[model samples]
Target: MEFTQLLERRRQRWTRFALLFTLFLVFISGLYLVVGEVFISPLEELSALEEQLILQLRLPRLLAALAVGASLAVSGAVLQVLLGNVLAEPGVLGISGGASVLMVLVLFFAPALATPFGFMLAAVIGALAFTILLVFIAKSMCLTTTRLLLVGVALGILSGAVVTWAFYFSDDLSLRQLMYWLMGSIGAASWYHHLLSLILLPVLIWLCCKGSLLDKLMMGEQHAKQLGVDVDQARWQLICAVSILVGGAVALGGVIGFVGLVVPHLLRLALGSENRYLLPISALAGAILVVLADLIARTALDSAELPLGVVTTSIGAPIFIWMLVSHHDSR
Candidate 1:
């Protein structure tokens, strides 16, 4: 009987994995169809144009979508574990807002500093600064999730206000650049972006996997301390890991939201709350969501592509609301 039960459990796990993998494959195939003109009757005759579209447009956008999705998902998973809150994400924690504010400032004051590397540096610095502030607030306020969230929300509002004021006073040329960047696009992606994301993503993944030790810490600080976990050290390391991942993502994709929050929660529901599975699963799920969303963003309208951020928000918000309602009904 025990052996039979074990077999059933393993089968169930594999079934879920297979489902997620199948979804990913379908998303990829759909993206190819939409972006490659494979389904468009008139465009099917134009082989050269199809090749150009696939090579010049679809591939880079897909890569950017993958990077942004994985980063946000991992970052969200880390934050949720660290704070013991289901809703915690990089954006909610003011990390993304902080990065945005700094990038806007750079654009306003020194337009020449708007390169990818420069924007990445500014984003990292901003995320790190806000993370430090959050730590201080959490420690001083007894480290409750509610307090942490409230503080983060306040900081996010402040950062947004700063960005708004800067935009109000900025010149038209820089403002146009800033506006486009804020809208978020994979249209500007290049081999350089792909290479940089490839380098940084693995490092962040490794660090986040290491920091998955925090899932144990989340059981309760007292229990974690008894288990020999260095609570404070683990917290700091996790914060740094999330900062790098979220900052790099925002710098690359410009404030795409909700993938992190939604993907991790969905994975947690499927795979349980063990960060070991949760982190990697969320990463894959996130990559799939972004890639599919980008595909729709490019093709859902006419010749004009929609902003990737707008696409994510439109899709994610409804799903998020449904999740909330379902959870409430279950309770």
Candidate 2:
């Protein structure tokens, strides 16, 4: 790359970063205002309680939401590139289902192991296992995009069946806990969850960004091999990165879906499909969406808080429908 080209790339990246930063600030302000109304005790006491709520309660949830959303979104972007399919995501690829299945198992047989680290570990293992399974199938079958999606759908159904069985066999308390987690919420967000996710997300993002060899692989494995890109190694590394990002988010927030799928696709549509730009931009957009969704989940009703998954799906489904229709019309 020439110096001028590099300068132009840097300028473009900074521009995207600035836009993302502005959106992030707007999201935080909106979340603060919405949460201020819910948690502050009285109108006169608003200022003091707003700070308290932001620091003690809402801030942790917001940070958690940001981490989960960013991780999922970036992971999805990488998956899209790696699989050469716009629809590939942790949720669609059965990674989230894998994590959910593991968590459900823990809730059933080992309720005492329901700590954050335990859940996160289980989620990572489950995600990696399923990812390996998918890779094996892909390689063995010379998988096309459609075939990969079909395989993922099959894995998702299998994981869901396992989860259902666990729920059926569990005690009422365990079942209730599993159900709530599956529905997904930022309600349980705490400093511990925030710190755990914070540690993993940044490192994973760094790894993904550094994997600019991804651009070579995106041209197709045969071409990547010809260009000395170590195709299988790159694929493995990408899978591990995606596993960590998706597994960590699911463990922390309990299977919040669609942000991963929607954010990156939208970013690609707006900014083109380069992973370097797509990764960070989609991360920021995902964080903004999730924080806003959290605000809605908390305050959209009179007394009861709604599940975060419900809010995301409500928003995501329409956007998905629009994308499908638009694609069809374009074709």
Best by TM-score: 2
lDDT of 1 by residue, 1-331 (tens): 9999986886578468847766775668455545533454444565776767666766676777788888888888887777666767777677888988888887767779978887887887788888778767766767655567678878888987888787777678757666666666676787677765965678567854764486677788888898889988988877887777777887888877778888888877766776766677677778888887777777787767788888887877887677756755664
State the C-alpha lDDT per candidate: 0.75, 0.77
What shift in Å separates residue 214 of candidate 2 from its native position after superposition?
1.8
| lDDT: worst 10-residue window of model 2 | 33-42
Q: What is the lDDT of residue 102 in candidate 2?
A: 87
Q: lDDT value for candidate 2?
A: 0.77
Model 2, 3-102: lDDT tens digits are 9997698668657675867676675755454454455533555577567776778768877888888888888887777776677777777888998898
Provide the TM-score for each candidate, comma-separated: 0.84, 0.87
Error of 1 at 308 (Å): 1.7
TM-score of 2: 0.87
Query: How many clashing pairs in candidate 2?
Result: 0
